[model samples]
Target: MHIPARPRQAPIVAGGLPADELAERLRQRLDLPTWPLPLHLLPPGTALVGGAVRDGLLGRLALQPDLDLVVPTGAIHLCRRLATSLGGSCVVLDRTHDIARLVLRGWTIDLARQDGAGLEDDLRRRDYTANAIALPLGGPARLVDPTGGLDDLRTARLVAVSEANLQADPLRLLRGVRLSWELGLELEVTSGEWIRRHAASLVQVAGERVLTELEKLAAVPEGHGGLIWSLEQGLLSGWGADPSASGRLRSFTPEQATACGLAPLERAWALPLARLAALLPAEALARLHSSRQLQLRSDRLRRWWERLEGRPDLEHLPESRRLELQQELEADLPALLLPLLPAAARGYLTRWRRQDDPLFHPMPPLNGDQLQRELGLAPGRQLGDLLHHLTRERAFGRIPEADPAGRAVAIDTARAWLGRRRD
Candidate 1:
C-alpha cells in the first residue's frame, strides 16, 4: 500500500492568507467543513483537482459541488471502494483513460489515474489553468498551482494550459467557451484567440458531445447569454449551426421563460431545444451528426411547437382528438413543449397544471386488459384502437375508469365507435 507523504510546507499562500486561514477559506468557499476530504485510509498520491478545486478556490461552489480526483493508480478499485464506503454507486466512465465515477447523494466524484509520473504532468495536460490546481488528500491542505491556476482563479481569467492540450480534444474547444459563460469569466487574451482559431475544428468532434455541452449551457440561468456567446464566437458555426439566428434565440431572455411558466426542470430541456430548433436549419440539425434518437426527439419537439405556433386552440377539436394531442404533447416531459405553449394553449396548460385532476392528466387508471375482459373484445388492431380511444376518454373523465357490468357501457362505446368508423 502506498503511504501518504507527511505534511509539507507550500508556497506562500497566494493571496497572503496563512495556511490555516487559507484552508478555512477554501473550505468555506466549497461549503465544506474541512479542506480536503478526510480519507484516512485512502491510498497515497490522490489529489482533488479540476472544477471542484476551481470552484472552491473562486468561492463559487454550487450548493453541492462534484469532486474530481487524480490518483497514481487503482482508479477503478479506488472508486469502487469509495462508492462502497459512502453507500454510493460506482461505474467506469472511461476504461481507456482509467476513469471511474462514484456517485454519492447529490455529488459525483470522478477519479482518474495520473497520466504521467507526477501531478504536474497531469495539470499540464488539463484544458484550463483554472482547473489544473490540486489539493493533496494526504497532507496539510496546501494549494497546488502547477499551472498558475491559483493566480488565474483569483484574477477571474480563463487561460488554457496549452494549445496542444485543447487541440488534442476538440470538445475542449466548446468547453472553453461554455466555461467562460458558466463561471462568468473573461477569457485570457491568447486563450480567446485560440478558441476562435479552432472553432470550426469542433466538426471533428461528435454531435452528442456538442449537444451535451449545449444542454449544460442551457441549464444555467445565464445560459441565454452563454448561448449567444457560443454563437458569436463561431463555436456553433463550427458545429454547423446557423450563427445568424443567435440574435433570434438571444431574444428568448429569462423573462420569456418566466412567461412560459414552466417549472425549472421543464425550462431547462425545452428552452435549449427550442433555441436550437429556432437557430438550426432543418438540414442543419442533420448536419451536426446527432444520434437518431436525439434527432427524433428534436423533430417531435419542433413539430409540436410548429403546430402550437400555427394553431394553439385545442378546445375546438373533438374530445378524442384533443386528448390524443394532449398525450402527444405532454409525454412526461412537458418542458419539451415550452416553445409550443403559446397563450392560446392556456386551457390545456391549465388542465395539465392540475396534475392531481384525473381528467386530462398524463397518468390515469386506464389500460387494455380491462376493456378486453369487460367488453369481451378480442386482441387485435381494432381492440387496440378502441382501448386507446377509451383510455383518453377515461383519462378525461368522460368514461368510467372501471366498468362494473363487465364493461357493458364500454361495450356500447366501442360499438358506437365502430359504427362511426364504418360510417
Candidate 2:
C-alpha cells in the first residue's frame, strides 16, 4: 500500500504546542534529570516513541509511565549491556523481533530495533496514528509523525496507520477500541470499518494478550460502551462472548456502582468483574485461559444472580437460602449489587460493610471444638449439623453472640437444641 505524504519539515508548533515546549514537558514528566540510563548510553538513532510520547502530548503521562524507544540496531544487546552495567534487570520480551525491556529502579524502558529503514518507516508500520508518533531522543524535541498523528490527536480521532498494520497483529483490532475510549478519541470511519473486517482474526492472537486488552478496556470509566461497540462490530464474537450480553454492560454504570457503596478500589475490581461476567460466561473465560479465581468468581456471580432474580427479594428468601446467599457472595456482594435498585443495593452494601453484621457476614457462634469442649459433644455429622444450625441461629439473631453473657446464652441454647435432637 502506498503511504500518504507527511510533512518532512513540520511546523514549530504542532498539536497546539511548540516542539521545544512539548519536549520540555516530556523531560519533566519522565524525570530525565535523574534517569539512571543516561542519554549517552543510547545509540545515535534512538527515539522515544509509543504511549509515552502520545500520553505526554495529552499531558496525562503517569508518574512512572513505561518508556518505549526505537533504536537503530541491537536493541536486546543494548538492553543487556545497560542492565549489567547499571545493576538493573533485563527481560528479553521478543528475541525474534529484537525487543527487550530494561528495568532500573522503578522505571521500565522497552528498547526495540527500528523495524524498517529509519524512524519514518517504523512509524508507518505502527497500528494507529496516535501511537505511530515519535520524539527523537538526545536531540532537539522534534515530532516525527509519518501518519499525521498530530492532526488526528488534534481532531480527537483514532486512525489506523494502514489496513496492513491492523492485519499484521490482529490484537490491534481490539486495541483500537480500547485506545479510542480510554483516551476519549473517536475511531475514524475507514479505520473503524477496517477493524470490523479483521475482527475475526483477533482469535488467532494469544489469549493472554487478548485478556490483557479486555481487562484494560473493562477498567475504563465508561468502558462498558467500548465493550458493547466491540461486540456490535463482531470483534469479540469469535470468542465465546455473547453479543446479547452487551445490554447487561450498558445497564452496569459507574454511578450505579458508587451508589452501591463501592469505593474507588472496590469499584476497580468489582465493576470489571461484573462487566466481564456479563459478556463472557465461565466456559468462555476458561477458553480464554483466564485465572481460575476469575472463572470461579464469574461462575458464582452468574449462578447466584440467576437464582436471586427468580425470588422476590434477597431478604424475603427462606432463612437457609438467605444464609447461603450471604455466605456464597460474602466477598463479592458489591458486584452482585450492580444490577439492583439503588436503595436496595445501598441497604445491602451498608449491612455488608459492617464486620459484626451476623446475617451479612455469617459466622458460626460455636465451632465443633468449642461445642465438644464446652458441651461435651461428640464429633461427626452431628457436630457438623450442630455448627450449621448455630451459624444459621446467630445469622438470624436467634442466638446472641456479642458479649460474655451472649456466649453463655448461646452455649445453653446449643445444649438445649442437642437435647431436643436426642429426644
Scored by lDDT, the top model is 2
User: What would the per-residue lDDT of candidate 2 be over residues 99-189, giving only the tens digit for each residue?
Assistant: 9999999899999999999899999999999999888887776678889988888888999999999999999999999988887889999
Which regions of candidate 1 are displaced past 4 Å?
1-20, 27-38, 43-45, 62-64, 72-108, 115-117, 206-208, 236-248, 272-294, 310-324, 340-347, 356-359, 362-377, 384-414, 420-423
Q: Predict model 2's lDDT versus the native.
A: 0.84
- For residues 320-388, write the lDDT of model 1, one tens digit per residue: 656656666554335443443456434445667786555556443435676666657678998778767
Clashing pairs in 1: none
TM-score for each prediction? 0.73, 0.92
